[model samples]
Target: MKRRHFLQLTGATLAAVSLVQTARAAQPPATDAKAFRAMRKYANLSFGRIAYVDRGTGDAALFLHGAPLNSFQWRGAIDLLSPYRRCIAPDFMGLGYSEVPEHQALDARAQLEMLVALLDSLGIRAVDIVASDSGGAVAQLFVAHYPKRVRTLLLTNCDVEPNSPPPGIKPILDMARAGTLADMTAEWLTDRAKARATFGAAVFVNPAQLTDEIIDYYVQPLVSSPLRRSQYERYHLALTPNPLAGIESRLAHSTVPVRIVWGGSDTLFPQTDAAYLDRIFPRSQGVHVIPEAKLFFQEEYPSVIAAEARRVWGMR
Candidate 1:
């Protein structure tokens, strides 16, 4: 069957499951809402009323998600990181439950501004940043512009330079500009099998772990009309001049320690880019390559990634 048809069928299947649940209970469970509330209280910041989850209390550790995802991406890692430090994960503007401002620039600079506003609102003077994929680009810009706020940097599966994007991503950007993003989202984001395959292609050490529930969770928001457009815009912004275009120059002069964790099997951004990042951030102390993992290392191997975070933070 065509990918679009498959997705439509899958949506029907999910709807059936919801109906079954409703028949069993008069009201839906509040587990997800309650969990979201916990995250919100920990990372409550001002740019918008972002949904987040916070765990533990001590030094701050901020987890940033990539395009099309929210704090939900860190669901597996949050519990593990919370015991060691205050883990703050926020849904960036235009993603998750965060306010999707219609007039917002949606560029790298605008994202950095929101980050700064968020930190200032929360009165968080400093933090250790852990970023993946597009989030890494945002974190790089944050570190470059506000070095004082960052104590350590952890970059994973990200391209630091504007010219270094992986092979096919540029073409996807071109397609988005040509008004093909909606179709692409329908193919890649909404389809359950495709979504599972894409996530597996990126970061599954064990493909068996890509469960139906997980795939449903990832694609659920995209089912909404506005959320899908917000996600598409994020990809469009990434194709332009990155906010961290001159990141090497900034990192070269930065005093904060840096570390890189890469999934050797990452099909999006290859492991070769890790060396380029290490060269740029000379003070980088370690580079770990998780052999079986893919781009989304935290999801595939949260325990390992959490342990690495603790080690990087000197909590281990």
Candidate 2:
């Protein structure tokens, strides 16, 4: 073969191989409930037992999830970030796989206290927090009071200023107030079709991504029994009328560095809320609007969340 022809053929073969490799990498891994099921750990707090996912080792990264959801929301993000950081995701009292006590206060203040207790129990002194929705409100309260313990505060499509629960969540809250939340949630838990119509519509922008495993993870524990259902309602009712009103003063003076990532399409907590959050935190890095995302955007873009956490941690 001529030398030029031989070189061209070799290059073409290499390009073909590269393309094949890239294509393989682009395909997502198989989704399985077992693969994503985190090792459930428990912390015995004064209020109740807090179930959490404690994985990896190194600097701590605490993940706080929104209402009507739990630590499962942070599973994908933990899988990505756990390699370099100790990822801790806990189920707030009255939610998820955690033990729900009828006597405890499940409000933002109580949740914050429980968070401190959990970290203390884990012996985690300092952490970077990644919070979403109502969980963001809890984190805000934490960062303000425990500023020294939090290294970086990352907020995503969360409660801020004027829209604490946001309008989209009002209907759900209304149902909870009306004593119908348990029945509605139980219906969705048992019926995939109902879940598709309700949970899918309310929580996710891309319904196809709301796999059977994800639905089971969210609803099964809450609907497991009557006590759990009652606990769920109690938690919802525990929410204070103005959870963020008091936090505003502290947020304006927070020393911990802040970063905001908004799902550009999240009607529950829109970009306007993100903008308001950015303004309140004196040390905010700024807002990152993911145009194709919504409330559970971290699940859609775990890599982005992990990257930002690492960047803020100075590990990348």
Clash totals for all candidate models? 6, 0
lDDT agreement of model 2 with the native: 0.77
Stretches of candidate 1 exceeding 4 Å from the true structure? 1-47, 162-164, 186-190, 227-231
Candidate with the greatest lDDT versus the true structure: 2
For model 2, state the Cα shift of residue 167 in Å: 2.8
lDDT of 1 by residue, 6-69 (tens): 4433553353344333332332222243465454643344444556666679888889887666
lDDT of 2 by residue, 48-119 (tens): 888998989998999999878888787777877788889999998888888857677888889999999999
Ten residues in sequence with the least summed lDDT for candidate 1: 22-31
- The lDDT per prediction is 0.66, 0.77
RMSD of 1: 12.7
- Deviation (Å) of 105 in candidate 2: 1.1
Q: For candidate 2, which ten residues in a row score worst on lDDT?
A: 19-28
